[model samples]
Target: MDLILDFFLVSGIVIIAIILLQLFKVKHKELPQKVLIVLFLLLFFVAIHFYALLHNIIWLIHLCFLPNDITTTILGPLLFLYVKTLFLKEDGLVKNTLGHFIPAFLFALGITIPTMLFNIFKIDTLAYTHTNFIRTIIRFESLYFTLYLFISLQLLSRYRKLSKQKYSNLTQYDFNWIKIMFLSALFIMSIDIGIKLYESFWGDLSWNADYISVLCMIVLVSFLGYYGVNQSKVLLPSFLLNKEKALNIEKTKDKTLSPNKKEEFETLKHKLEQVLHTDRPYLDEDLTLGKLAQQVSTKDKILSTLLNQYLNTTFYDLINKYRVDAVKEKINLDSYKNYSLFGIACECGFKSRTSFNRIFKKHTGFSPSEFKNNTL
Candidate 1:
């Protein structure tokens, strides 16, 4: 058990250190990246705290410089902010959200600082550390973690929905990594809370279950390091920020369009189809609703409303539908017979084979190869 715990502790420390170095080397850091760096730094301190505790390093533990408890308070806020900064395109987002860190700040001031001062004065801090008040505070921290994690997951879901509306290719903007991270954190938090509750009622178990949580943390850290390093900033458009307005628009979709408005949308839809069929703008792998709107000579919001209300489709579905049709057309051609399935998919503006297969199957109920075979 000791051997396994040592391995996890070392692995977690090394993973966090490597990620920190990588983040530090970034030439230009955005708000999300900066938040991510701080997030990992706190994780590093967490790793060190566990190491110190496990090794019985009295001085290191007593120093309270790392303040693992404070990190528990801070991490939740940092995670929510990371998701927010990734999706929201607002000025001074980090600065404006400084209030979120107040709990962590107060924790450091009330608990960690006093502990450090006691250690400096060679005072016994056992009375303060082992109190019922501290235990209650720890429980509250667990609740705090739960609340922020829930909020982050909710925000991620909304962002994903909005992304599908605006961007055709969701490869870069998917934020699946963030979802995985939060889910993993949720798993770890559940384990920790369960164990704590068990200990509160039944006293400590013979074996340490914390080692399991620590091992999971190591794996989670490695996962975050790999994906976080490659993650691009997801700056949502200004219109997307107003989610209330978007919701109102969705609510009004059932309302009948005025005849003039219906005619206007009909003309716009005709022009949109003409441009898509003639110009083949969907063939751009990075095509977006705004780009397609420019090609169709209409505002993106109008184009969006046209697709949503009149066509009974989304921008993503409409664009991908054309691409799939183009693929089917190419597949049926004699000259394109020698082209590989992936080759045909790429030529039809499908960015990746996985997306192509998934989208093709979604639309035609057959994989790309199956479709080609049946048609041929």
Candidate 2:
């Protein structure tokens, strides 16, 4: 048991060090900046948690600085915001999002005010944890953690739905690993709740369950660190590009298309199709609406509008339609006849067999192998 505690403590410090190193050295700006903030907060929280469990060390730190449990209040908001910032185009700390961090602010105040008074009067902090105020704060933090975790799950679900609606190659953006991380959090929370309830009813268990919880948290933080560092940066959906412009265009479309504007739209449509045919950008699995717009020499809004309003499809469908056609064309050729269906899919810019099979079937109303066999 002591060995397990030592393992968690060592692991927590090591992970925090690695996270700090990555934050300083990595220079790419493809992902949102807020992601690093969330990762840092999570790693810091876990490290502090394990630090507090070590005997003598915890007392020394507590004696110097007030013990804080604000990390509990902040973790949920950080996770929810991380998902939002990753998927959305705008920076996450807009006025609308200010409310998300209110709990953290409140918890910090709860801790700081009391600790300041204690320090001012030179009062001992030994019995602070037993106070009703502290107990109430702890309860609220636990309740809020559960609530915020569910909200994070909802954010992930919403991101998934939007991604499927707008992007073809979801391998990078799916964030399935995040779902696993959330479930792990919930598991830890359940164990924590159970431990608290047992302590309340019976008494403290002989084995220190809080240490076990901290160990679980260290593992969870390790997973969070791994995923945060490796996860691919997200591309904003095309429809979300210049949202004000989209809204204005949507409102006016109900009235009429002016002659010049209609002509421009036609030109844009021709250019879009020409680029799709000539350049074959869909063969690049990481192709995005913005990238396609650049290739076609059109604005993202105009290109997305062309696909959404004119063609009545999404960027995902339009691109995957091309990919599906490319695969069909390849499968029909004598050169690809001996190749595996998955190999043909990979050659045709399908990132995974699952996405390829799904998209291919959606477009042609038949699986790749079925289509090939029927044609043969």
Taking the tens digit of each residue's C-alpha lDDT, what string does model 2 give over 1-376? 6676776778787886777677667776444444565556555655565565565464444443433356677778778877877777564444567798886887666675566556456567634845765765675566688788999998788667556444668876758888998988888888788777777677768866666666677777777777776566665654664434333345344345677777788898888888889989989987877788888887776777776655556788888888998998989798987899999988878898888888889889999989999998
* Candidate 2: pairs in clash: none
Give the poorly placed runs of model 1, Cα more than 4 Å off.
64-66, 115-129, 206-209, 251-256
> Scored by CA lDDT, what does every candidate get?
0.80, 0.71
Top TM-score model: 1
Give the range of the ten consecutive residues with the poorest summed lDDT in model 2. 245-254
How many clashes would you count in candidate 2? Answer: 0
Cα distance off (Å), candidate 1, residue 39: 0.8
The TM-score values for the models, in the order shown, are 0.92, 0.74
Summed backbone clashes in each candidate are 0, 0
Against the true structure, candidate 1 reaches a TM-score of 0.92
